[model samples]
Target: MRGRHCRSGRTGRKRRQKQQSHVDSVSLCHQPQYVRLMRFLHKQGFVSTLLQPALFSDTGRGLQTLKTIKPGQLLISLPESCLLTTATVLSSNLGHYIKSWRPRLSPLLALCVFLVCERHRGEASDWFPYISVLPTSYTCPAYFTDDVMAVLPASVRRRALDQREAVQEIHSSNLDFFRSLQLILSLPVEDVLTYEALRWAWCSVNTRSVFMSHPSNDFLSGQDVYALAPFLDLLNHRPDVQKSFCLQVKASFNNTTRCYDIRSVSGTPHFQQAFINYGSHDNQRLMLEYGFVAQGNPHSVVYVDTDLLCDALKRDRSLDQKIKFLRENDFLNNLTVSSEGPSWRLMTALRLLSLPQTLYHQWKAVLLGQAVSEEREEWSLQTARTLCQCLLQDTCKALDKIFFLLQHCDQLTREQLEVVQALRQEEKCILGSCLEALDGMWGQRDGLLSCQPDVGSVS
Candidate 1:
């Protein structure tokens, strides 16, 4: 959604001139339409949040405090009727058609189909007000053309390509599916299931939906996953900011209705941008899924795919059996390198990968948390450091090529430039940290082996 706030409605009030990054007076006050909407929500018990324009950045719109919101104050609460959950889709007229498939599709995919069909119905759709506010264009990497996605680093590129492939697959499947049902339903195929329209709906759900687990007893959908929280989804994610509230669905007096509630964990200052932490998501995730990136994200990480690690391990013949073992056990994928050296799983895998054939039988026992001698522990740490050093060297070369491309490229969109720049910075920083950690490990290698069992902190 565009900023949680919109630009409209002003009376005879004289407006104060302010910079584009500063909060304008007109936006600080609720607009007429928003006032009307607030009034309507108030009747439904959602009076705490106000849709106010953001102070900084272009097209700024977000929720602002109407009064001094104290800590533990209930920030917002909406009736369950407002949440667009799978239950809504299962109850829709399109539900029967979705159920006609031999093996049922995932709740998310089924919801996508329902959304497209409902959208085609225009004003007749029940959630038109919510749909009307959804942004037409999402800046997520999935929305980017292949050429633009190509400029991104391998870590982001892999994910973007995977998403692209998934979207295409879903689109093709849904197209074939709806076409088969067209005659039975007396509906035009193109009007309901076009790739462009489906893509829009998919992106909207991907970017805006919040995870609100449904009650276990509810039989509507197997997965207790994402739900659209209409106006609440407009708030921008601030990973660095302190969280103001948590969301929940609770039953009303007679348990006849469930209301969506935002219970404040801390007080929000008046006129300040209220933010929700979308979990400790890395920059790649935020950029790929949410269509925006937070500068200086502490959770930022660079991924080291297993294929690269396997290539490096191939040099050591002693690791052959161990590498095969790791792959067979499913521990060879999704390894990550962050500011704090290698991830625990990657480090453990490397430790096992470097173990001598004579001690290979101990791998399972060690993984089961059995105690190992100090010498063995030091050996494992040393082996892990060595493997990471090799990884760092290879990563540096890859980064160098990307750097050169970024320096020489003449034409790039603002979004592409921003993503590339952030990727380069994060990757370089992670590699630099790895190199520094390895150097420290090397310095302590002799001391650790000769004088004491203690190895200096590797992280």
Candidate 2:
């Protein structure tokens, strides 16, 4: 859904550019398209290259600015004692630690510093300039020590230095290195380029939603986030919010339709289906456009515990870093677990598997309260069934909540609304199959009999 529609606009513009360049490469100031061209150049930091008129009249206008949030003026104060303590445990000589890092000053390290700074300041704007200028590839440690770091922006270097020093080091001996680190760390990186100019990643003021990290980079389907960016994660979860608004679905089973609601869960849903079409819910639209909608699905309170995923993640080097970071920083901690509610129990049970709701309902209904039935040897099947019902009910509520959020979504485009409609159809389809499967079971004399419900089309 977010594919062709999102790319067409860019493709069309590129085609139009060929014609525009042939017309008046000069007098760019006078061209209406010049403003947009200038904006693009500014956003990508290509103003100087494209602004040279005599050399090339193709793309002009240099003193352009993007819609990016401005760089933040940061001030993070820690207890002097804590700073002193950190200075001691993290490094013996701030100079040495900075020196140690000298062997490993990768771009990832630099971004980490900038991110920490932004988080400390509590502003997306704080990272705007850094994001625009950050390097994707890093040179060797030797270059970082002699050439790269030395030439970096003074501000960036200063911030980097401060972050290092905060970890604990012999402050007096490493003062000079710390200061140098700060200055060098801030310089605008060289030869940096990106296919997609992240022009800016600002917090959505109107939508009041934000995300921690973009999913397209090096991380897996759901990695790349730092705990400091919790606000960003909530914002990126627009899919979950959108799903809450769905009235029904085209269930995979039996192609049946049934009504669903989103209000079962009490949390405030930020938008509704109608808002997807108004072009106003930019945060939500961003997710849809990026094909990150699946990432934001309304997971009924059911899911696995951190320990399980962590153990699994440890064996894979690719997932290890993200898993460790999330654990160490407690990113998953922000995801609330409702201990005192039915929704919590239901979600917990359902998250265990990726099966349908009707089966879940029947299973949970049988095993939720009763003692282990002695008739059959193993209770695994019964236990599994009970959990399924809990999941089903919770899923229904999750969908209802999404719809509730959608009702308030007054700013999305018409096409986005169509996305919501598609999802609703899917929900109905699922529910219908569940009903059909349950009809035969309802007639069974013994509710807990082994005559399981027939399989449905939905998997």
Candidate 3:
């Protein structure tokens, strides 16, 4: 009788558990909050964002908590007091961010290796053991403020830093392990720039190789972090740059020796997009959020010394000292740019050159009967129009990039129909991308769409 009762109890418990499981499934299917949360994840990262609508809908708070749960997706809470915005970009590198970066069974080090392989198109015969170990590196800790430190675990304290360009390495035996692998990688660019060097360090320790963002020479002392001289496109480069020239890596290429061999991912042109120098300040903040951002307690900002380049241009008795300065100060050459421009000589020469991007040009236009000065009452509308014309005519990729520039300078207002309407008329068809531009006043202009529904609405 006792044995029979025990069996009956077991059967009853199993039946109840089955009923509970069925109820849980029904609740998950019907939940609205689950739907919204999944949508948010879908829009955020590379892999986590790729799961079909059904998979993540029931994940609930499982994905949102910040116990360092996700690899590529970082959780951050910034005070409303800060002047900065757009801090979401610092979480991962550009080479393999599939638009989603949630953590997985493997750490970030492992995922980066997987990406390097996935992005590679070369034959399997070309994959080498040494080259395969490039992604497991996590030496540099992502830096944050005091508030940021409190939320992380005790183990994480030794991992990140606060300085923008400072390469804050995590205290791990893996550091030495990474250095060993660097000696094996035959990176085309001999010296890895600061960020790239850390990436190389991580890649080496991963026991798997990954794609290098640029060739070894991409971070030349005098070039833009975005492009090399042979490289034409500057905008496709990631904006979160390590703004130091002090760090670099050493590599050797002996493919001929067949000592260790792998096929190369040749450089591709990325010039179709335009990048701006807004990177200078934001790069620091981005690293801060990413846990890889490094800094000191009492921070100091430093810039590249361009005094010699400016002086060289000024002393040259060539065509126009301004042109020489212009070439030297090209925005793409941040490693050689500075506040000093050989002082007055460079400025005066720049003024005389009639460069379109100059106070000289605005003045010249006024002299040539184009733009009117602030002194004249009639100059206001014409000045705005001229500025708008220049903005419209520039080699722009998307309205968002253009709008970003305009927002930096308050002179251009998105609501100004005179400028926007004129632009819409000339550009022919509206690009599909502009509809969602944050800086554009498209919703207000929906009235235009109502009257002409077929009209394309761009930012």
Candidate 4:
């Protein structure tokens, strides 16, 4: 879709063409840069058999199939030499000088440093062609102004703040190294290692880097480590798609090539575009790092602060110890609301924190998945119902506040409004699902209580 939609005004209409022109100028006008990048790829033996980069109206840029790719076709492949990874940076001519700073900098941050240094070099840098095509700006929430950020939900704001702090920390801690490299390379520090430059590089890596398990590299210790696959990154992300390629580092002409050996996971059909899974990331994460949000992310979740529950129970001073217990056990935060309802820890906390003193031990056993008597189960369910209803009420109030802001906040920008609306809608969907699950549980509870023997009819 176009980046912005007109809001039905003469001024808005005037702005639309200007904005579209700017987006196209960056996305479409960079054809020569992209073409040169592909040539660089071909020189390095990174070839695509079935797919090619094509611009679309809906999504700015993505891979379009050149031919009908079958179930087991190797659509694309890239040599290991093509990837701009940590190992690649370490092995570069500048690696010898930069290795001394490695003790303080992370592998990822080291790569960012390499990018900034190379960026300042212009055509002098070996990867200048690849660097030229990198995006000039990002749409991530971290780039949002304070006024725009204030309208976002608490969870998103918290995440954005945390990201800002991280970028600041990285910038501050590496300033000396950044300066040293500038002096060593005889370049201006302001133009090279500025926080803004590092941030752009960081986001570029965050959004596009792919995992590779290079057999030769042992410095990276994880299931798989990330590498910036240049041409591979041109393909836009589609979270739900039948992936038809597998990445492996194979021995190539002299150096190893990170080959995308394609074999369709499911039966392949006539699809216009191809995509690879970028991990099961939620919309919040995608927007924070990648500058985009999926319409209906299956991995989406809603977070209610633990403090909300504490506020709900403020009048009941007797639950203070239970709250303390919850904190000690590390169950007092990230109370997630999902399609399946409140997470297990959340439900357990709700039951335990609200249980009566007499039944506390029984409830604790039940929380631990032990058997409990029918009377205890009935009592627990009743307590759970009360707690769930309270949570539901709080969630609705939260939604109402979002609606109120959207209705009354006249100062929101078109971009800000879009972000707010998307986030609010996603949260509402999760909350609505949670409410449905609560109602179903309540119905089951009523049925259980009704089936119990009537003591009034008994002797």
Candidate 5:
């Protein structure tokens, strides 16, 4: 994403910049592990001569185009042999144990086990080239320390804790299967399959695996849909890519070639980093799954919890009934504020909560987009403004706490602090935007108490 060219600079400066770019590209391309990976991929019938690896100042590792690429050009075609799928695991020595185990392992757990075992095998493993380049440690929330976790917003922190527990439970529940590995492995099974080892393996598979459809396997516990594509995973996500451009390069399994292919929909100049769209994931999801957040992400959002909504709109005894209705209709979840202001779901919930007991019978109409009265409309707007203001204050306080932690806490690494700060900053921006939209709507009505709308009007 950082490969954009500077076209307006002076000719001498441009030439020097180009020279430095060439040097950086060459240095990354010649890295020993990448060199080994390329050779291995070539031997396995994988070829992508159009692209080479490069390190960016922002995004660490990404693929760079070797030449000017044209629209509809095949950027990468990874052969089946190079793909590490469940089929690969089933065929290996580990496959025999998987078949004989009592409780079938989930497709995810199987991949995690394979990665850890293979990594422990060192150079003797066939995937040594690919495995050698993986990050020694990851920054996913599971890897975050308690001090760093304390700085995360309440909702995000809860989800992060759930993720950590899920991984831990997976490891704890599979101890018997791990123990059985003692028969095949040289070292004690406990030494190689510890919780930390499994955590590393799980993060590797979770963050980098590509989706590849596999037929139903009775032996596997979950849906068979994950493949570790060796060189293809090097392509980092670019959240800013236009949807139309992303559509041009279709990625799918090529049945005829038995390879995974990706073609460019638009042309890219030589020496620029080639990126792939990883869907329109927000900064929160990106941080949760991939351990990184995008800057200026269009999909970023600020979540409003059910408790916060209730707290802002607490007015009468009917509050319980309104909350029950909202929950039953599945509107309580996914309540958020974004760059587009409060989501429709949030507005609908607010409208329902603002209804007076005398008009409670018409609650369904409110949800159906009918405005009962100008007073009710004003109430909803006031409640929304109150919620946004509360969240903005909370965000500012969180930022202050983060600054204090950064100054005094030695437990958190620089990368962890930066990630926490970025996530909070993004939430602050979204809340500010929501407040602005609410103010604009209030200004449009001139004076809330005086303005009146026709009863039963549809908004």
Candidate 6:
């Protein structure tokens, strides 16, 4: 009797779990825009019936397979007709005005204009299904408010500000061109193409567009290599998805079918979310560009700038010469600390800086990885320790400020707060790991130094 009761309890739990799963899948798939998108894709002959939109607890909205997918299977094959590219814009109703404009528009700006115009058109637009499903607003740094920006790391904050300025410049420079559209748009061109609207459109293109090579055209000013793949863009990035399943999904233009296709390199279990690699980007790049950060990202790094290095090592008369050498050799930039402690470029720069003015002739040898002396090596290690300790302190303070902001800053949305918090935590983790590695190295060196006799004192 006892055994039978336990069996029934287990069966009841399984049934409830299945019911919850069904609810999660149906919630987003049944949305009006998603329903319309599916219908439109089918009408255009998109034939990946195995994949369907499903919501996951961790990843939010992503595509999932209804059944187990086999290796080398075609996951998605979207017709060229369905893609939104600069070519699509050239052939659009606005194409006539675009072609006649005095200066040609870059492929990117052209896409931004098209997205904004079509979004204004509502259901009247031909690509309404695809446009309707795109995120109405993006969380990219360009959209961050001043208060939110204040919480970002110093390096990331600078880039974030630059991104915002670049978008603003694009809008300011093209205002007259946008005004010219009054001839075609029923609404006031300025009203529809406001800075906010243009920002939204820019973010959409920047974050969601896939790279699809197109032929050079006199009509476009810059690189013609972006395509907006609608349903396929729904796939999110997962860093370890490749390692776990060997799922090498490659997206390419299928010239034979005149469509864009994605195929899996290995089998994926049924009901699992399908992910695509967006290159091996660090959390900083991911957050700055895509408005999200990946936890446990193996590629995550903590950047160390020249100013910070100078501060840690104590500025000396030879600092300018050292800086010049680094710049000339292309080692001044990209100095960073990772899980393995300071990068080689960082250590090399430190070794050169640690040398006395008397031993300056050995600078080239240091760059060549030739060991100069134990004293110089010890100096470089000490300098590295100081820099990492400073970084750890700064990271802790940033985390504290973020926590305070999360509690007090009502101007930021819940999502914005979460992004800021996650970024700071990731930095802290990297710094902590780096400090641990540095400590181990420092301890080993201390023991070795104690065992060796001083060269100056030796008989």
TM-score of 6: 0.90
How well does model 5 score by local distance difference test? 0.81
**Model 5 off-target regions past 4 Å?**
1-27, 243-250, 408-412, 449-459
RMSD of 1: 9.7
In candidate 6 the C-alpha lDDT for residue 171 amounts to: 96
lDDT of each structure? Answer: 0.62, 0.29, 0.27, 0.64, 0.81, 0.81
Q: Can you tell me which runs of candidate 3 are displaced by over 4 Å?
A: 1-321, 328-388, 395-459
lDDT string, candidate 4, 1-459, tens digits = 243344456567667644632322123324888778878888988776566666765566766655655555556567777878878878876576666654545667878878888887788887987998787767676566665566666667788878878887889887777777655466587667888988888887877777655554334323435678776677666565532221211112223334644333333333355555566887777778787777657778876566666665556556577777788878777667776676776666665654556666665575695535555445444444444555556545655655665575554244555665576677767767776776676576534665433222211
Better of 1 and 6 by lDDT: 6
Candidate 2, residues 29-64, lDDT tens digits: the string is: 445334443353345333222112111222121111
Supply candidate 3's per-residue lDDT for 115: 37
Residue 293 of model 6 has an lDDT of: 84
- The deviation in Å at residue 448 for candidate 3 is 38
Which candidate number would show the highest TM-score if scored against the true structure?
A: 6
lDDT of 3 by residue, 189-284 (tens): 133223444454333322122112322222121211110100010111223222311111111223344111111112112111111122333222
TM-score of 1: 0.72
What TM-score would every model get versus the actual structure? 0.72, 0.24, 0.18, 0.75, 0.89, 0.90
Could you tell me which 10 consecutive residues in candidate 6 have the lowest summed lDDT?
A: 450-459
Residue 444 C-alpha lDDT in model 4: 67
Ranking by lDDT: 5, 6, 4, 1, 2, 3
The 10-residue segment of model 4 with minimum total lDDT is 244-253
Candidate 6's residue-wise lDDT over 1-459, tens digit each? 999999999999888756633423434678888899988888988866778787777767788877788988998999998898999999998898789887999999999999999999999998899898887777788888887788787768889999999999999999989988987788998789999999998998898888888999878797888899888888888776666432346688999999999888778767767788888898889988888888678888888887786665444656777678778988878888887898888889877777677887887899888767877777677667777778878878877877777787564355776887888788888878888997788787643444322222211
Task: Give the local distance difference test score of model 6.
Answer: 0.81
In candidate 6, residue 247 scores what lDDT? 38
Question: Any runs in candidate 4 off by more than 4 Å, and if so which?
Answer: 1-30, 102-104, 184-187, 214-224, 242-263, 267-271, 369-420, 447-459
Lowest-lDDT window of 10 residues in candidate 2? 191-200
Backbone clash total for model 4 is 4
- Give the range of the ten consecutive residues with the poorest summed lDDT in model 5: 450-459
TM-score of candidate 3 to 2 decimals? 0.18
How many collisions between residues are there in candidate 6?
Answer: 0
